[model samples]
Target: MPPALNRTRLAWAGDLPTSRAACGMGFVSTPELGHEAVAFGVNALARLAHRGGLDADGKSGDGAGLLIQVPHRLLGGQYAVAALFEWDPRARAIVEAAVTDGGMRLADWREVPLDHDSLGARARETMPGIWHGLIEDPGVDPDEWERRLYLVRRRAEKQADQEGVRMYLPSLSSRTLVYKGLMAGTRLADFYLDLRDQACESRLAVFHQRYSTNTMPDWRLAQPFRMLAHNGEINTITGNRAWMRAREAELEPELRGAVWPEGSDSASLDNALELLVQRGWEVSEALMSLVPDAWEGRGDLAGPVRDFFRYQSIRFEPWDGPAALAFSDGVVVGAALDRNGLRPLRWQRTRQGLVAAASEAGVVTMEPADVVERGRLGPGQMLLVDTRDGSVLRDAEAKERAASRHDYALLADRVLVPVERHHVDLEPLEDLPAHHALHGWGFEDVKFVVDVMAETSAEPVYSMGDDIPIAALGRTPRRIYGYLRQRFAQVTNPAIDPLREKAVMSLRVLLGARHGTLEPEGGTDRELLRRHHPAVPTEYKLLELESPILGAAELARVLEDAVVLDATYLPDESLRDALHRLCREADEVSGVIALSDRRSGPFRLPIPMALAVGAVHSHLLATGRRMAADVVAIAGDAVDVHDVACLITIGASAVHPYLAFATVGDEAAPRYRKAVEAGLLKVMAKMGISCVSSYRGGEVLEALGLGAEVMEMCFSAVPSRIGGVNLDDIERMA
Candidate 1:
């Protein structure tokens, strides 16, 4: 028979952990110290218990977990102790089978002795199944064997899961051990017996007390996710997940196809980082690659630093959003923040070599004279401690080492190709035609829209709030982007102020297909520090498209040096097919335009601009040819700021609403451009993104009624919780 089921029930009827910012705290002392630090860690959790969420029952917490260095005596057998209680014969057989299957030999299974009779009702009710297993390994290299042991644990857990057995791995590494549960932070120590034992000690302990936005709590979804604890959200997680899927061809079958735990964005990030580390990347380098600072347009940073980020950006888009994280690999402990400093992380150092960090100050108390330093983690900064070397590296020192590891500037200059642009000097737009009747719309309605723009040029404001049904449910056909709405920071995390914090924000973007050869399928490259080689030459023109609101003359001038695929005359070819062919055929396909020349009731482009761009971008990525060109939307249907922002959000680098230019005339183009820019800024500012590039291809949207299949194709991983219109509806609408 299968192993007995022992999973925590999914029952949550209370406030979520994400309703407010989470409180994550860590305590680490030098020299592998014991109990004193472990006690401090538990005390820290108890002090911050109020930050955790409470359910309707006011007994269960949102979730809490603690990670600490593995006790050497436990694995070294110096203090070996026999089993206090005999393991069941059936359980032993299952554990042995799992261990053998994972390429490890099992020595013995021991049940952790617990006095359930003495436990409080709440602790007894909320506890999960627990056990301690020993592996047969001769005294050998610890790091190598421990890594293998970790993988073995993972594989064994996967096997157990398939047999309907729920294995709760609080900790599986020789270097680290985890103790966690679905209990209030204040009760974590009481529920996990190890925490209560004074003899159990460690030099480092990281704790996380979660408060998710939605109150539906699952015990398995708790923080301190195996490797790290993250606060704040990953807004670009949809696109980030898509990129990970695209790289599946280069991963092992189990890793490529394994089911991810249903946690928050932080869980996904930890999974990715684990994979990268298993592929030979240093933890610090992996963190930098995943969440780099604003470097593209900054001249203040060293050339090597800028080059490092520029090269990494092509391979991985920034996990852009507000975030603060504390991570550890048993020997190395660290913390980092996102580029936008929307989350708080404060740290204090004691003279006796203890460093404590948390979301709030005073979580760990120390005497005034004992305090060596007190500071907070800034945007894109990191703090790392290496217990092996007994050294601590702050942001600058850590980044400097990462940057200087390779000649990124030389690599970038040799293989990085930028967009090409032609300089056009032109007078302000003037003497335009009265094309108000072009689409058969009344001139007065057109005038009213244009007049409102003229009046609101200084500060565009909207009086009519959006309350209509989404396109999937509406009677009138709408653009594809209309089906998805931009999701912004809510109660859990704070949003950035574009005007107040422009220094850290960037608008620069890089467009074109990647140039490097594909990494080998189902394999990892062990050369983590080698210079990157591009399959194609990296040197190309850097084309910066500010906005799509372009005049005909300006558009013509820019196209002189570009290979333009005119949407106006695709002949018998589908736009998607044409764009794909262009990407494959051209040596340097820099730009694409979706043009609408029809001036009748079918005023919209045959293909909705958003759908066209999204389809093209998704196809290019699928075919391993996304860096070929930038998509431009020269649409007639886009006039208001909403239309333009929608097009850009979907995938277009820039959008030219030429119809608006024609209707408003040349003299009004500048005013119209200002109004549109202001409006787009307001829209983006709502989500706290400062620049267009960060927002570009973010897939930071939620679909109210879009079907799953279409969303998977054009906007995969986008949150479309409420399924609605299918492909049939989309085709009919189009």
Candidate 2:
């Protein structure tokens, strides 16, 4: 099987690195390089282990696909996606950081010298586990890995506790998958990974995600600290550290070990200063005193502050190199990097209402603002995120640097023009799935589809729940259903012969309750049922409980009974829970329909949805594990197919006829594009080459009864496809 289809392999090695070898100390395969890297930015890096490239060119020219999480008011939700490489390396760093290649400890490091050769090899080995961990969620099943983490943290926590210390929570939010990459087994490593555990109280966020012990005032002592994440190499780092250490050559804070192990240089510098934050230097004072952009201020500064920068520069200039960095101690997420703004960094208030910064906008929510959003964040800009006061501060005069800088040699790099963008002109996006409606499958679609199979036909059903959602959507009129409440009425005839008026009337209930047409409570139920009731999801079709188990019930469906999941909430578990709940409610009377936003051959998830995770959903659909197995046993022989629940998910990359066919129409009306593109693909069994031609006219009208099909009547006219058989009917009959 191809790599993407292989479900058993630990995809984590391909994601998060665990061994020092993976982090860069070990072996790695390099790809032939070219312009692709230059076009895409950092995505050109196939395997992004920290490297001191020998005159390496930095560009995402390899054309790694895009990943982002941006605000979308339409669904009242956030849009997030991750492809290869856009991951947080900190998860693995936090681990491999325990020991060094020489078996000798290194000082706290804020920036890795880009020229160091060994930095690449040692760090390379530590990466695979990071990739592996990010792609593979520690399943509900406890295997050795979970046990190992437990042991490690337990031992580490004990070490901390003995000295009044702390450890990462079992939830491991700090073990973050900041970025990831892999498309059908292709390698992916996009950006630096920085993660914070998902806990009300964060360990990394709190006491020590970034703190490390260092020398202070001729004696060692425990001290609070400052943290920094760099996007560009700070060329001045070595000299700066050397000068600072000379200033306090004698002191070794005993608390250095308390915050971090000994010899953490960059960390010590920050920690030593943090030791002074409360005493005199405000945060700006401490940071400016350490990594001041330049001595010149817009105008005024306190004498000490002004005098401090003037003296600091005498030692060395500002840290150089490009960087989009962020750091926090659970209290404040502060960021400062090279004064030149040589590296890309964008920060903005998140939809969660928290301040965040990353090399890319999607890291926060994939906002374009992530990349200098419409010219925000000029050179010398610093962003301070104060969780304590819920305030954000910018340098204000930062943009002036761009105006002052020399321009004009012009004619280089295809005449780089600053692109202009306003609110997305959604009109051009018509016929693209999800203009008004959320475009992918949710939790409800799983059970609703199972319900459809159980109620649709008497033939032994082997329908793949990984089939297209539109197929399930069209089944209602044909004695088909993806859920019990589909029609909101009980089937009067089990055989459902010819599905006449009475049977169709039984469906009146299920079809009526869809979307906002009706409510789920008694008042609406009575009044609506009196005048016109919903077509019971059950009466429309009987569903099979393939596994006697499932999860989508909570994603967006109304469950037949109250349900609670047994699995422990792990990383990203909150999103999963919220989805489950959404399914339970939204898919109450009808079968749920999930859609994929990416090009997953079979899977689709909108936000933070890893590209290859389709298998997770595929496995769940096949096993029906989301629903309790007992539910299947109780139904017994009555239902033709054995299943606890069902799912009907359209592949994220599936041609969306509704959206594709739209030439000009919106939520209110739609007109599909006239031009058609023939997708050349390899078909099954014969497996040579095949062409699937699609268009915008009659075929779609035929599907909606507003158009007609011409190709031997074997095509669907949904705006997206030109000529095709009605796939739902095909799946059922096949």
Candidate 3:
């Protein structure tokens, strides 16, 4: 059989750490094209060189790059440029052929002049031959020409990958070009000789000096990406990437496999934004959709703006994390901050109509007298400068412009249907002793965990640290959740105080099919109308739940039409075989797949809820059916906050802790559910995550005792170092 889809090479390396970094990034824009914008960007990079990593030699840096409007003065505007990393003659030939097949003529090829002496020893060894392929446009409108160029680039990339050619196109557009490499920030302009040439001028320039964190430094990993330069890490990138992969079938043909697997979290975000822009979304609209503000609890926002965020939440989860972004599409330049405002992005405007924004102030040196205004972007704020009209838009004006494009309040009202709450008769356990034994509920669990929540409607607090031995080293049997430990933010990424930041935190979960294409095919007016004003299809429906913790009645109502799968193993079945069987069964079902261990008896063993959920979730992802169904775990062993969080982190949509409810009895069940919900939120806050949607499938845990094989089969995306037990050992322990 083929390897599991979620299996990554990083797992075999014994680590699956998430990317985290605070890098130097900025942009400079002018009302008119000139050499000053390019020169200012290079100067900014030099000033921020301290924020980037440097090799032992001091000459080699993490990465640095400059993204600027196409230098019409140097290359002319009649032809579109493809800035490529093509070292091989064969690869260049293949790219030229792709351009020809894509219905474009290769007008000329210009070898990008470079000063090799300026590059460090390491960079020189890894650098590819840089060149610009100028393709003649086929007498079409500007929009059509851009679309055609995108198609050609995608086609060329696919062909190059298939041919095993080491080629990369950093930018391919008539409007913009990129000059970047793996070198010290101060040497960027010196290495790329074109940046120093006066003829290489632009109206806007987005620059970046990367500080390597999760991945090693490479030429292609340098920013700014085709559209943006990012300063902070994407904390929920694992889930974000997985969700995007699940939606591959729904993507436009040209963007089918656009996200590169080897790219950093910043690159992934850029890829998503580029796809949205190519599909007709305004740049600000797409940015707002991806990294929305804390609008759910804010009474200060306009009604339509609140509705806009709510409507967007249904289609996409916020890319929750610390982020400070600077973006431009040659004409309009802008900057934005994530909801948390974890990174600094300061801006200043000169009296000469020069607007500059960077990770730090003073990046673009201007005399104090020339500074017209200076400010920093607050949390969930944006600043845009449109060179065409010389219009400057701050947060409110920019967001309002995008929000007013459609009647979002009406759209949300028509599409988002809240899940109905029903009061069902609670059925008490007939035999207390039998239930306790069957579900592994002990005296400590009832007294310390469940009873406290039942009485106070709050998670139980303990003063001392955990004294019990970790699962792998303990002699007693342990659940799968015990093998994994929750990872919290530290150092560079600050953990949020859940109580203080309650306004930004959310537990809302939307259940049902997501709309496929943002832009419809054929490009007809009717198609465009449907794209902008979307409503749930007649045959489909969406159910929104305020929290993932389900009460007895809520669980029953949700499972009424859900596909129930048995998560119990027969006496002869191995744990691995049972998990595989459960995955196979769940893959065949649509809508909700409820994996329940309610069938566990003296003759059958209950599969650990986390294990079952992780297995089935990864299986569905591998088969590209993950988006088609939601996994709601009706678990017997999931009795605490950590247990529920583990299930969710491994891809469970919602969790019903049946055993906890049964132990607490009917009257206290609601309190128990609320307590669990509160605890779940605290867990998310500890990791600096704001929403449960982004936390789902986030893989924010570290397995201390699980063997590599076990991790690969189940928690494939989670970090598993100091490996110990395998499947057989796990089965024996169980």
lDDT of each: 0.61, 0.25, 0.82
List candidate 1 stretches off by more than 4 Å.
1-21, 56-58, 75-102, 113-127, 136-165, 168-171, 257-261, 296-303, 418-459, 462-483, 515-605, 616-636, 652-678, 690-694, 704-734
- Per-residue accuracy of model 2 over 8-89 as CA lDDT, tens digit each: 3233323321221101100000111221211121221222222211101222111111111111221122211111110233
- Order of candidates by lDDT, top first? 3, 1, 2
Q: In candidate 3, what are the lDDT values of residues 571-658, reduced to their tens digit?
A: 7999889999998898788778889998887799888888899999888888878878889998888868998999999999899888
Give candidate 2 regions above 4 Å deviation.
Answer: 1-226, 249-283, 297-324, 350-352, 366-375, 396-734
Q: Per-residue CA lDDT of candidate 1, range 1-734, in tens?
A: 11121223223323444434565555455455666566666766766666777655555777777878765554454211111111223434555575676566666665664545433455446555456677665355666665565566556556655766654554556666766666656656665666666577677888887776644555666767667888777766656665665565554555553225354677778777766655556778778888888775456777777877876765666777778888887778888888777788888777677787888888776777988888999878888877776577888888877777666666555544444343333333232333333222344435656666855573344588757686766776665656778777776655677666666665455444443212311113334323343233334543434444555654664455455543432335444453345334432453433333332222322445555566666765576345555666666556577777776667776776766765655566677777887677766777766556657766667787777766765665467888887655654554
- lDDT against true structure, model 3: 0.82
- Between candidates 2 and 3, which one is better according to lDDT? 3
lDDT of 3 at 613: 93
- TM-scores of the candidates in the order shown: 0.78, 0.26, 0.92
- Listed per candidate, the RMSD to the true structure in angstroms reads 7.2, 30.6, 7.2
Highest lDDT against the true fold, candidate: 3
| Candidate 2 residue 270 C-alpha distance from true site, Å | 5.2
